[model samples]
Target: MFKKPIQKYTGKIGEVEIGTGEKAVKLGGESVLPFYSFDGNTGNTPKIGMEISDVYPEGWTNTLKELYKDVSNDTVKWAQFVEKKYSPDFICLRLVSADPNGKDSSPEDCAEKVKAVVEAIKTPLLVAGTGNHEKDAKLFEKIAQAAEGHNVLLMSAVEDNYKTVAAAGVLAYNNKVVAESSVDINLAKQINILINQLGIGNENVVDNVGCSAGGYGYEYVISTLDRVKLAALTQNDKTLQIPIISPVSSETWKSKESVEPEEEAPEWGNQEDRGISMEVAAAAGVLASGSNAIILRHPKSVEVMRSFISELLG
Candidate 1:
């Protein structure tokens, strides 16, 4: 029997570094298709980030509700608990409460929470805005300043909002910027171009390949990410080559398979486990597809994902 020869990616576009003031991170080194254990090298493996919020989130599933319980209500304490107990490599802080109808925390208010959380942990941070473009810009502008020199990775700078947020991250924090686009390869590229045009170097930008849940367009999202990696490696497209970022928690949150009651979907098994498992599954899909950093919810889910990554790397 003839053993099949394995293909190795050339050079190392994924190996480029993202500057963080004095320090930098090597983005590439993946020799495999995401997490194909039986395939080439996934040198960096995957990183799991625990998600917290400056204000309590509404409409969370009972599974999350029960696990986090009271701690979910307090962002500062929540981050500390995750950092001290769970020991995740990163902590993702969502500024959801800054919404006008939500906690309505101003940019200043958001910055303080960021500062408090930053002081609470040594693990790197992923600070995300509430998704309201304008407010997110304002919130992250302050957040960038507060988190400056800490080398944190800012959650996002989308096509429409890239100018303000990207500028803030580059000028204020010297933090890494996540360039997000809906699940379109062209859009992903365009945003990357836009960020670079803003005088923010590629060394500071990460591609946020759009995300989806297990049952909701997962295949499409997966393929899109796959294209990104191929473009980066094969096409020599630098825009898609930067470390991929995905908010796996937010993406999986909407899946019925992740949030519906067990009784409503008995084939899924226990409700809590089903939710956590779906979150893990969605995350695994992205990891398999090609994501460098993922923001996740639930300590249990993060634990399982981290274990899976260990097995892949080991």
Candidate 2:
């Protein structure tokens, strides 16, 4: 009985190599479905990214607030702490206070913060926003300029507002940019198309397939990531081949499965344990599905995931 050999696609964004080693982590180049070595090569294992914030998150689970409390209020300290303590390969910095209806920090304020963190660290940084479309447009523009030539990897330029952010990343900083769209494959393709049209080099872009916590909707995210890999290897679509990102830590915080205390949901175990489980499950699922990078919180979760990845690669 002869089974067909798995097909392999070598994906690239302009000149950027997809996956690990010379690239961030090997993710987009697989001939078969995930883990089906008989189908193709799973040359690169997943990589973990630590998530840090510019300001304190008002309602982060008490468990996390306490462990990271010492450095949580200061972005430079937090980033340095994670890099030194965890040895994370990448860092995700979220500019949350810049939300117009939130902390309302101005573009200049955001730029200063980014510059400070950039000055303090050497690992690649993923600059994300507070998810407010309009505010992020202005905020990322200034921040991108301040990070010019640092080769920073900007968190995102999504649909409806890719123009400004993509332009700044392409023209000013000459750095990498993440293009996020919903779980929809078409929308994901479109955003990647638009980014290239803006003259942003392909090698300088990654794609975020939208973060999903455990309990509900995780399947959709995982499936979409699988589709992107399929498109890259089978369809050989360049737009879909860019590295996929998972903001696993932030998305997990909002899930009821991770938040309800044991007294409230005794069968689920302690709230902290459930939360940590959710984080691990989410990381495992995303890693298996083909995400090259993950943004995570909680030192324990970071340790567990790193160990898991180490075992898988072994």
Candidate 2 residue runs with Cα over 4 Å from true position = 1-44
Candidate 1 local lDDT, 1-314, one digit each (tens): 98877666652335434423322345546755666545666656566778887766667887677767778888888887887888876788888878877778889988998888886667777888877888888878888899887777777888778888989887666877888888889998899888888887776887887888765478889989888888776667766667787888987776777777877778878877777877898888888778887788878888888888887766
Per-model TM-score on C-alpha atoms: 0.89, 0.90
**How many residue pairs in model 2 have overlapping backbones?**
7
Winning candidate number (lDDT): 2
The C-alpha stretches of model 1 lying farther than 4 A from their native spots are: 15-27, 36-41, 263-268
Clashing pairs in 1: 14-28, 15-28
lDDT of 2 by residue, 255-296 (tens): 998878778888887888888888888988988887777888
Model 2 is weakest, by summed lDDT over 10 consecutive residues, at: 14-23
